[model samples]
Target: MAGAVQWIAESVQEILQISGLTVQTFLVLCSTFFLACVVFNRSRNLPPYPAGRVPVLGHLLALGRAPQLKLTAWRRQYGDVFTVRMGMKDVVVLNDYTAVKDALVDRSELFASRSPFYYLFDAIFGFGKDIFSASWGPEFRQRKKFATTVLKNLGMRVGRGSIEDNIREEANCLRNRIAENNGQPFDVAHDVAVAVANIICSMTFGKRYDYEDETFRELTKAIATISIELGAGHITAVFPLLRFVPVVNRPIIKALEASSKVKNVMREEISRHRENPRDFLDFCLLELEQQEKVAGLTEENVMYMAQDLFLGGTDTTANTLTWSLLYMTLNPDVQNKVHEELDAVVGKSLPTLSHRSQLPYVNACLMA
Candidate 1:
């Protein structure tokens, strides 16, 4: 019995020694990591990092629902520039207009590259083939030039079969849609989105869909899903390693599925455009045929380019219009002034781009 007890005690002592060594090793590793971080920050001369940054997660948990508000608060505390640790990456935040302009406008070429850290957008944009997520390089510059030229041509052309005509038609459709509500309370967000999306559809596909069209509805839903999932999966964007976790990656999966749906629709449209040769897709296809090898203008690139245009054009414009309507609703005085300006300047006629300079107040309101 004494020998048994001694054996058990020896075993327990061995286990305790092992545990002590393991803990000491872990502490050393942690200290080394933190020391490396400090050294790296000092070497880079990084801006002020916020307090309360936990290991691994960094400031993510503190960001809460409205990260902008938190960032604004941080800006006040840490000046216009600060280093924010997001997950495992250190990000430099630029606040205020002048700083942003200095970086984006003055040193535009230096900051033209998109961060490969945006894993969600990278996936949606097909691994940087799309303009929005593409790295700043020869291929991106060529694509940008092509897109700018095409858009400029489309925007400049006026009268019957032009982009202006498409916008006017969509505006009329929106007006009719509102009129159908019969002065009753109705949500205008979806209708506004549909109108904006239709304008893009017309520009891209040389076709427009009825507001209730099933395919169009599906496309918009997918886009909306992607937007929502992007927000939901922001954590994964910062900590891309989390994407491997089953439960945590639900949003990423949904985004991928939504992106697939949108891409499938775009692919179908591209196939149709191949035979008929119409609108932006045809323009892209023609370019692809000529410069496939030279400029990295592949079918994949064209499809992604269309996706970028569709996403960029639709959501932003719809959100802006919706917010303007909401602002007008909230501020009756401002709305009245805008109404007076429109009535005086536009005077029951369809307002054209030519009248923009004439209606300064309206332009100010729109700019605001």
Candidate 2:
């Protein structure tokens, strides 16, 4: 109770300073707010939360390398549906594909909305506005529709093949970058990251950064740091007052500064696209113009949309490619099989999407 008051006191002081509220009035409002939260939590008949939860951290420390593996083990004991508390939040983990399909496909609307972490999201990007992470409603639906349409036209779907062309070109660039390494202890991770990031970059801004680009390095580093720091600083999500502590606050500030650089680049790309639209940004601007004629779509909306593509697209793809390369290097037998498949199907010719089926083993390895 005292600890809760201490945390709330920080926020209360800010509110008092901002709104000129008396201490008495602030205390009453704070009491009522917490009381309501307690009432609401007790009233809702939530899923079965697993026992053996730690004090404030909950089961967070128990999560292992593969969270799925942990959940699968738990499923045997607790059945397919159960919740685990992370911080103060109860996250219901669905163990099997059936449960996932039921929740996401069969009853999507009930589970579609995202929890708005006021400290985490609202402090950085505005709450519920980006492409994938946005609130699942009309705005998100329209944004997704717009993104897919732009992507489809740019050959994301198997037709005109502009995206594939970009991939092939980037693949060649990656190959040359590797060749430049001269089989020494060159950073495969660095090369693969730039290669993957370049593909998304080409689509988003009609240009790719050099592998040695300082800004690109900072951007990727920031994205990674944000992910790590968020997991570490998750308490801030539940209790925003944690930001008053320097250790917890520093990472958030660094992430925000890094994000600002990425956002600025996106805004610049948007500005450049205004005259002669060419890339995905061009397509988006064109779509936005049409949408504006009809209604809805702000510049801020476009900035977040582009940022989503740049940040989300690059980090995940790069991580996958890096892991794939790492695993292939680690396992000789799998690597040899992949080599044999490539030798048999691809030969001296360049590899393309067309060779996917013929090199089934290699395809499976890459996909896996």
Candidate 3:
């Protein structure tokens, strides 16, 4: 009877040990299978992106540094239109100008929906209805038509004589500053930027500041800084997820804070002129009143319209003028032709709008 009891206990112990081992082995196998699926499943829906990435981040790791160069290289490697998956988002890059035109202009409606990354702009400026950054919809079209009309009314049909005079004065000041540098190695980028900024300032607020003025300098610096950062490859528009990554993306947050202050300053200017307005602010206020009658334009939309004027009128002209001087200085023949034309028409006096047509060569030089 003792031997029988001992044998039964031994059999029970062996069965329990075998069951525990089997359960452990099954769990290990299940875990391995799950991990494998996770690794392989990421590539399943992806549209043939470049190889190399951690489990879910698909090529996002590569974008941690010099993303533009990497994008360019990917274009070189995988042709112009390759897919890049970043945290479940599949971004298709249209590298060629033709593709971009086709998307932005041809099938504009389908692509008109601004990408998800534009949320940052909306969050920062509260500008979901602005013409430039707004999503494509009825509101966008309304704003677009209004912007076109206002801009045309301001400058297109008749010469903006007052605006031109303001620009001319600022441009003349810029030229004198450059001349004062006496061809020394100085950064003319800032001076050129300030001239352009003052042009917008005059257009918006009916005022222009001197080059030596501290407030004006701050405004221009802020503008230049914002513009360059916005265009940089690391911009949040390019990688929206970067906004959440604190250690790697603190600069982005700081920039947003700075930009918000700048926009506030702009809004303060608008508010100051609410009672008595002039120039473009006056036009915008009038538009807002009209929009109120129509019950179509929200305040947010109106503000974005103001933002568009400030951004569009400032940065583009600045770049054009800067590049014009840069190319003219680089090409002596072009520079001499410009000087000759100036000598013939303006003759060391400040160039006026009337002399513009007469000085075609100078105009051509500028165009170049």
Identify the leading candidate in terms of lDDT. 1
Q: Give the TM-score of candidate 3.
A: 0.72
In terms of TM-score, which candidate is stronger, 1 or 3? Answer: 1
lDDT per residue (tens digit) for residues 186-233 in model 1: 999889999998888877887888888888788888898888776664
**lDDT (10s digit) by residue, model 2, range 1-368:** 99999989888789899999999997899898885665335225666766656656667777656767777778888888888876666777887889999999999988897777546565445565666567777788888887887777767766466588888889988888888868887678767878888888887888898989998887777777655655574567755667789987776687677777777788888888875666788877886777743137877778888888877777778888888888988999999998888888889656887788788788788667
User: What TM-score would each prediction reach against the true structure?
Assistant: 0.79, 0.79, 0.72
lDDT by residue for model 3 (216-325), tens: 66666665666666666463554566778877576566557656666776677767766554566666677677664323775556666676667666767778877877
Query: Judged by lDDT relative to the true structure, which candidate is superior, 2 or 3?
Result: 2
Instruction: Evaluate candidate 2 by giving its C-alpha RMSD to the native, one decimal.
Output: 7.5
Off by over 4 Å in 1: 1-53, 59-82, 95-107, 156-162, 275-277, 292-294
Clashes of each: 0, 0, 0
Candidate 3: residue 324 Cα off by (Å): 3.6
Candidate order, lDDT descending: 1, 2, 3
Residue pairs in collision within model 1 = none
- Computed on alpha carbons, the lDDT of every model, listed in order, comes to 0.83, 0.76, 0.70
Report residue 241 deviation for candidate 3 (angstroms): 4.4
